[model samples]
Target: MRGPAAPPPQPGWALKAATAVVYAAILAWSVFSRGPEGLQAVAMLALGYAVILGLIVFAALAFFSLWRRFRTPRNRARVMLGLGVFLLAAVVPPFAEHNDDNRQRDIANAEIRKAIDTLRQQAAGGSGAPEDVPAIDPAPRASGPYGEMERVMKTVAGARLAQHRAYLQELQEIGLPRLFDARRLARDTGLIESRLILEQAERLVPGYRRQSLDVLNGMPALVRSLTIADAEKDKILAALQTSNAASNAKLTRLWDLESQILREFGQMITLLDDNRQYWYADKNELMFGRDGDLRRFRQHQESVSRMVGEQEQLGVQSLAAVPQAPLR
Candidate 1:
């Protein structure tokens, strides 16, 4: 009995420190793997709630058990310290991720401002579209959360610029009425085809489902992108106006006319579609004859055409008055 065997030496301080490090690392990994966003997305789900509640209960029970086992005040304090560490580790990941997203957003905002500034400079220089619309190229390779944001901002700007240029050209050349007429005709043709298909049901084509309006499958949808808010549009317009008030005025008029034209067109189309029951389709041919609704359709078409003509003429005159308009 060598000195009554000094009670087994307590685990070395180094061992205790290592154990703490390992525990903290595991907790961190568990919390981070799901990510803050993922956790929030699932938090309301039944399974998610159960798991979260279970974790809370387990943590509480474990804390109390450890508290009792470590009876001495110093030991009790150490246990409390461990509990604090566990809570800190659990909370750090969510806060860290939230901060990172905010940082990324700030960086994206800076890049957006820089891009918009480039556009302003291009407008001032009159180096429009086909050459440099946005005048700011997206990063050659963009990845990660903020990278995606920058990419989308650049893409929307480019698309909006191209659309603006196209509208400008239409005003100068073919005119809005002609452009609108072509679209209306295309849509009407689709409606006629759909009518014929419905009249014939599955008899017109083999294996065709009566429920499927197959002929209208590729019709253009009437949706506007909402990525750019009104405020952003105002900012862009202000920037352009600063460069060339006359040119920007013309552009603005055309954009306004486009909205009005589309609205009228949609309403007319909806009216025609809703009263399709009054239209008769020739069973053997792709022909549709408007019956009782013929007068209504013609009247509406004439109204739209007249409105569009008036708007187009005004937009065109404005464009003509502006010498060296960036539109060309």
Candidate 2:
């Protein structure tokens, strides 16, 4: 007769313990290592955990199959307990790590929004530009598709800047705020959250600034001619210095506003100038129309505004010599 069935094989406690240790070591190592390529590190950890999870799943299946052979209640209970531990050890960490990554990305997105809002307020305050307008320098004609396009775009952007600058000058001349019931809102740029707004401003600013260089252009010669016999010019100048129906002060704020817009406008010009191809439309036909006479005209226009205070005083001095006109 056959001897008593061989005693059931003992559970592989050593293998399970070693597996637990290995899994713990890999998780711990992946969690701790930080490096220059942070995204790469995160990706690597994700991959590592995925591999570890796969291995644990396979191992747990093997353990259950082998342990089920035993008929004793105590042995069966022990097998179930080991399975619980293995499942818990393998699944918990990857879930926690994924949640943490998502949370961080959300926080970063929020901060970026705050930064953009601040930028917007500063731009709209109408306080003028960040710095003095630089003298316009001619750039070499761009070649190739990209270069040509950039140049053309710069030209277009520059043209737009000039038009806005002219509009502002006209506003200052007749006085937009001074004449019209103009209202202005200078909300804080810190509140601007959108990147699209910032990008739009970036694209528009340089061209706006480039065109403004001539707002004051040829204005002096005309002012000199117009003010000669007409005392109204001087009066208009004085009205500009003080508040009227338009501006509350001589500083129309448009000057500063234009100045501010120009800063960005100037930048676009530089960017377009640098990348000519983006601006270029065709080989024979260029992007924007070029004008150099504008450069000289702006010089005099600025000089006129700067001397307005002294010019006003001179007007007072000259007024004493002229006969007073009769009122109807």
For all the candidates, what are their Cα RMSDs to the real structure?
A: 20.8, 25.8
Candidate 2 lDDT over 1-328, as tens digits, reads: 9989977655467655655666565565455533225767777876876687667655655666675554444454355455545555765567556545444434433433332333223323333332311112113132222222223223323332346444445434432222111111112122122223334444554454444333223223333343123564465345333333232122233344434443443443344344433334343333433344334334544654555434334323322111122211
Ten-residue stretch with the least lDDT total in model 1: 215-224
Which 10 residues in a row give candidate 2 its minimum summed lDDT? 179-188
Which segments of candidate 2 are over 4 A away from where they belong?
1-14, 25-67, 70-111, 121-328
Give Cα distance to truth, residue 321, candidate 1, Å.
Answer: 24
Name the candidate that leads on lDDT.
1
Tens digits of per-residue lDDT for model 1, 1-328: 3566544335557656754675445445445444446655544443554475457645655666665545544454455455546655776568667656665666666776665555444344333234334334656233355555466555544444454454344433433333224343445554564333223322322222111122112111100132334564454345434545454454455445545555555555566568655544354222335544666666766876676666555444432221121110
Score candidate 2 by TM-score against the native.
Answer: 0.23
Q: How accurate is candidate 2 locally (lDDT)?
A: 0.39
Q: How much lDDT does each candidate structure score?
A: 0.46, 0.39
Local error of candidate 2 at residue 207 (angstroms)? 4.9
RMSD of 2: 25.8
